[model samples]
Target: MKRLSFFVLSIVFGTLGLSFVSWSCNKKETNTIVSRELSSKKTYLYEDVPFDSTKVASFFVKYPKLLTFQKSIVALYKNRQYHYAWFDKKGVNEAAEMLYNKMSTVQEEGIQKNFPYKTDLDVIFQNSKTYLSPNLDAELLLSSLYFFYAKNVLTGVDEEATKKIGWYLPRKKLSYVSYLDSIIAKPELLAKDDKVVLGQYYKLKEILKKYRLSEQKGGWNPIRVAPDFKSIKPGDSSQTVSDIRTRLFATNDIASDNKSKVYDTDLVKGVVKYKKRNGFKEDEVITQKHIDEMNVPVGERIKTIIVNMERCRWISEEFLQDSEYIVVNIPSFKLTYVKNNRPEFKCNVVVGAMMTKTVIFSGKMSYIVFSPYWNLPTSIINKDVKPGMKKNKNYLVQHNMEWNNGNVRQKPGPNNSLGRVKFIFPNSNNIYLHDTPSKSLFNEESRAFSHGCIRVGKPKELAYAILKDDKNWPTDKIDAAMNKTVETTYSLKRKIPVIIGYFTAWVDDEGTINFYKDIYERDNRLSSILVEEE
Candidate 1:
């Protein structure tokens, strides 16, 4: 095969914009793609050996199954000007070896797709003497394998699939070409403890490994359901109590498994801790529902953990580094505020019901409106107001609502649907966080009663935290504004990013894994796609 010149290859693909020439296949050649501007001129040059188009074409022909990654593989090669990225004069480089090992054990990362060229990759690494020369086939195969691993692990199902399943959060876009460049330059980074996926993803993987080991060692048996059992409250004694004890112990909800059949004080404490972590009421009672949750097989729980890991992959680490931000986890029915990489506080929140699910997205919280008027949405007006008006002529008067320019809006006060204050994050979805008069709903184990927007339980505390740094809004002023009958809007000097996300499984900073109900039924939808691919 004739040696291909970098300048010639660039001209053939004029879109690459070639202006200089340099070529070498020697071991000492620099592995770099440089683009610089000369005196009133732009120049592009590759400081490495360029691959022959004929060899790349022949390799694809032999391995036709990997044609799906043809575009990506070509782009990757063009980015480096066909440099031997996966190998040096000695043998396969460290990055290639590390990626090969990761691909071989991709299941540990919750990926189930089998590599298409697994045997070919094994042969190259297993017997390096037979593949001594700079093998284009091995290099291309590694590049293609990396893309496959990244697509399934780093990026979940495509954006369209996620959006179809009601996940509207922005999908993370990563440049594998640039990522490979960095890895090739510093091989040690491949071995670093730093996370390549989202921070939560790494945490979930750690939990997954433990769970899989548990599953392999004969997981816990299902708790027996008694025909006469109504509920197991504190001080109740039965075989079920012993089963609960063992189950809770397996999950570390209880420190010990004494195997005692009596529901003692220690058992009660364990029940409370389990309920709190599982989004149930923190009471010393074990109902059938709680039993059902505990009885969910470890295998199914593993699948749930894997599904949430894919969700973590969608989030960008850049967002987590914000100086100040607000994150509302829909499944957990909780909101957390973070400042300077530390969680300031967390509060209970009420999200939308199944039919009217809150959108999963992110925006900037720029304003806080105190005693905000409730401009009823069209759906609410058509569904509730119009029908109620037909039954009662004075419905508007009774509800403290009035007609404002052909639209009915509730007056700003304690009676307003948006109870005392509202946090506005401008977006097309028209959803925001606000206070509600239905304080009792917050006490419910499953608080998904809102129309679409989030109903915060501690609106006053949230407002105080948001405006604590600003001298213009003191505690007295904030209280006064919230109590006023008229609507008052305050613009925040620095906008905080608000991310409304859905995560059914999460690991807290304390390394405790908490699981929540998939309120919107999104897990099965995502899991189905993964299963189909598998």
Candidate 2:
């Protein structure tokens, strides 16, 4: 790798905006002869030349608008050892053309940022002969353009912007320098699915297209019904039933649209499916609430899907590389344990309420504590314990709480706030997954009643799964540990990655779109930012 001697930002060219003519025909003729000779000898595609760093610095100085990508372009040249990546002996490489097309249609990729140098780039692409000679300006411009596209489409909004909107998840880190090296080696990769972005992003993009098409078709009509209608059950006949059938068919919740006026078995099945997808109870009964949800404008749903797509952009492809991981989606109120890239099991979970919203982040679950004590936070103690103790003098004894080192802590028992076990992943947020004493809360469709930590609905099953590989802790031993009065901690031999995320819209494995209420009103905040920018 050759290093550039000249500072890219130091030199200034006054005629940068003026378009330069293509290289002379004599130079093209000389390159043509050299190209034929190399092809006839069956040697390398293009001969490597010593890259002049001074020329690259001069190119950047000419187009100061592209100075933001100067460092990335320098790294790219170093990786390629000063070789021309976008140009071969014959002409401009296919990868450069594909990249230009991708950048031109970035809006189709859900990017809102306008490219400042797009007009200059268009001039370069339109002139076929400009790439015949080793043009440093064109080469560096395309390299900078690649980085720009990678940052906007593959990476996402900046970290500072996401933090301003309350997203605390670790942003995905990628080296565009190395990525460009790989692309230069194999130009065909540009046309293939690179798997650079999250798989969910492409899925949501497809759904977004479908939704926008629906919106263009004037969207679906709002279901009309009398105010007195509290709920509609199976076997009921009304005009609202026909409207519901049409709405379900439009959304592909049902296979065919019979336009039936009666709430028959098909309609009941569709309603149940729709309910389950929307985080509602899987029941045959349809209430006014369901009708209201269906009445929401299609444009609004499209916006929600787009907002969630932006969230997906923040996730890295490295997450899919892990063989075993746990994902807890806050809005969905569900915990999924995936093994071998397949979901092993999913269980209901209770997340933090709006006032005490759960933090979005990732951690390594390295320990599980059985028969755990509920070490109440100071806020909880001052807010709830003191108030209760004022009313009932025996509050501490009745709740099995004791004063420990001048702080209140609940003893391990069936009635303990942290039921019988807790999964620990140390972080500054002081959040962990634990079992709750109130089991009935899991039965409810919406379970956001916790402080900041997550509550597992099936804690015993989770314990068994986490320790199933360890012969020392069998199923019976696990149960015994949970039932014991003494708190026992087990260090996991293999730490699983746990990711807590917030997505109000998700596509399931069956291609069904699931929508949930923005429990913390995050979607609106993000949507407002995106709209304001637009």
Candidate 3:
């Protein structure tokens, strides 16, 4: 509601904080130029007034920055049968004012770029005499502004650009033409920001405001730690403990600082909370890496949040509609099986190593293979199998692998590379969730040792959870199948959607914002692109 201050058509022109662009128009032109008609009647109904369709092309010729939206504008007016959207017989309608206010203050949406035609737009609403009258420039500019808000605040960077940043999730396509219809029917929809963006984007926006406020107040000083600082356990006492407490308190990680040089129980709670919120192992011991995380500049953290907000824009809304689905956050190395909009189960996972980064995409998991054979891909065969065969006489026999029709395949057993089970999604990347014989790899803090496919730590538990409601395969049957040497496949009656997403920053269900290391070095790349676009 506070943003409505900009909606007043009579507001002083200079107060808008942009230079004005003056224009002269021919009096004979029909909606192709601004008209000073003081007695123009204002009407609330959109269909009551129609503008010349040919003027749409001339409007773009004047404001070239908005030329990109020319086609969308044409389609929008055609959909409305060339009716006036932002104006009525009385004056500028409430919807146009709302859009103008939003466009004026897009910085709150984590967009630093200034609207290209901000000055030109400000001139139309310079005074009630001009804004209240139906002006063709104002009508077309408001329409262009709608799309600007849609792209920056709702849809984010283009789909192809997202792919360049390694985000493979399907982008949500929005038809602003139809969206505008809904907003006009209920102008109150403009007040609900979350209605435009994913709820996650709104949460990040809230945190971004907090971080910006903190930055204004001189964000926390970096905590000092020794180069060889192995760790400070619960009972340890050192000056660094006091520094850590102060740092945590600054970020609301701890209830109070206490300013004590002791790693007391209170500090342990703060440490554990901070660690958990940071995608670290929930531990009271403060390690060097933890201190480094705390020392990260507040500016960098703000950028990370904004970058992830862009990513949230790319996620399809249909992802939230599924009764059941699985989400694997590659940076967090975590897999969560969600059902009915709640997390059913969560487990640690090992993603692809740096050299062989896992592909980010979505797929429908329609089948599960129990006691599956590890069909090694050609890349692995040429790189690992043939080299081993050349070095040792019985390399295949020693590793429980055999040549099957000129291809190497590991037998289905405890030693099998794919361990006991594999969840198949049938993607071109040859990536799937599977149990791994190298189970100990999951114990590592940063688990990214796998060749490509994800290695689930608790494969049997996940299998049972997925088949819990199915009468054909109970927990016992799943266990029996997992233990058997023969490979068995079961088709699921209903496919579960699996989304492999990469997010360096995410707000958890508990409302705690979590930050993870950019394992694939993607955060900066995306952040740079966003700033460049600005």
Candidate 4:
């Protein structure tokens, strides 16, 4: 691979700028006096060697910054344990050590915890003459992380669903990690006299520079006071109105004895509204939720967006240009499907409740079963099943539940726990999309109500839209499979990709971020990781 010019590398990093990982912990004052290996470090010409051998070991000793850089890489792997990155047992421990070493180096430099160990993106770009760009580094890092993340996660995969994954043909190749090698090796960006290359790099630098970190607000915080008179609605308490409006109109310097200057009604309303929006009782008082949002100050919202912009950098860069896909915004409880290149449909889909927050991931629709039989997950079976089984083994028969070998499954019917239909894309995680009979729960504003499976709204419409492209197929075909007592499966002619993502702030068609509440708390969790990477 040729050396990637600074210009080209910058552009690539800008688009996917947020680097990887760490945890959201309070920043401890880095006063812990840990002993550093006093032997001075030295850097040599870059050489590819077996991972974790002398070459990598030497690199760490030579450039401590490389350690910081490696810490960021390790973070990517650690997060993968939670996401779907693949690795084996030995790989997992090795990667963990790499991250730990890097973190130690940063700690020696008085770097704070919670903040990611920072490396200058430009420094690595310049190092391409000797060392490869981070693009290559990222490829290696992702590879290691993928191996470990996948390995660790697979240990926890449901035994029943494990067999189903290989059945779905692996059509889509994972490309981004491999692609980095080709991208960083491109020389056009590296040509020293190429002003255009430099200009492109600068432009991308400006773009990445725009990404500010999201505000790391936690616990109860302070509040601010703002008064607006026009917000007074009908049925106002005259005394309340008089007192509040007086404050709005009151002189800032007034030490005068005004007996009845009430609270800033609008500010209080902002508080009440904030409280109402969050999972809290809306009492319009200057309570915690209101105080936090109010104290955030409008000036900081842009900073919040900037931080979110950095977040885009944290995702895989090789995105799908064409596919039918569904994205459920947990904060919004809304689902969107994009066909070709435009959003063709949207619906309000319910997600897992607070205790069982919906995990964000990406997947594809492999098969949709009509009048689907629900295989009760072991976790639920242990919690909800045995109780019902013990209380009434008849509960299983009454609900058409049956045991296949050791796996407990429900027979397809109106009363089955899974409601009527299910959309399955075999993943290592065993999570799926399905329709639920608990329709009334959807009406709730804070609808995080499922155990794990995504409960789609108007699943019949989804089924039809997915199948409409097929020739001569009608509802009767579906009816043919469902009417009979046997469990039936129908694979679609075209598979739809489904991405369960976590973006507290994301760009719309206009490229403006439509900020949503961080329902899964992923933003803060990942935000600290991003900070740690830096």
How would you encode candidate 3's per-residue C-alpha lDDT over 1-534 as one tens digit per residue? 111111110111111100000000000111111112222442235566688898889888889989889889999888778888888767877787787787787887789987788887787777757666678888898889888887888788887898887666666755677777666656666656443455667667788999999999999898887767798998888889999999999888899978999999888888988887677778777788899999998999999989988887776655534657777888878887766555567788888877778888888899999998777778778888899999997999999888899988888898887889989887777788988778787777788777678889899999988998899998989989998978999999999888788877776544567787788998889888898898
Q: Candidate 3 clashing pairs?
A: 41-89, 41-90, 42-89, 42-90, 43-88, 43-89, 43-90
State TM-scores per candidate: 0.88, 0.86, 0.88, 0.51
**Candidate ranking (TM-score, best to worst):** 3, 1, 2, 4
For candidate 2, the 10 contiguous residues with the lowest summed lDDT are 17-26
Candidate 1 residue-wise lDDT, 1-534, digit = tens: 122222221111111100000000001122221221222341112235457865777788999999988888888777666777787766677778888887788888898879887999999999988765567888899889888876887777887888888777667666766666656655555443233455666767889999999899878888986898889877888999999999999988899999999999999998988887677878887899999999999999999999988887766544534656777888878886765555565687888887778888888899999988888766668888899999999999999988888888888888787898998888887788899888998888788887788889899999988888899999999999999989999989999888788888877656667788888988888999889878
Pairing residues by index, what is the TM-score of model 4? Answer: 0.51
**Candidate 3 structure, TM-score to reference:** 0.88
Model 2 misplacement above 4 A: 1-52, 55-64, 126-130, 191-195, 384-393, 531-534
User: How many residue pairs collide in each prediction?
Assistant: 0, 0, 7, 28
**Candidate 2 vs candidate 4, lDDT winner:** 2
Worst 10 residues of 1 by lDDT: 17-26
lDDT for predicted candidate 2 compared with the true structure: 0.74
Error (Å) of candidate 4 at residue 490 is 0.8
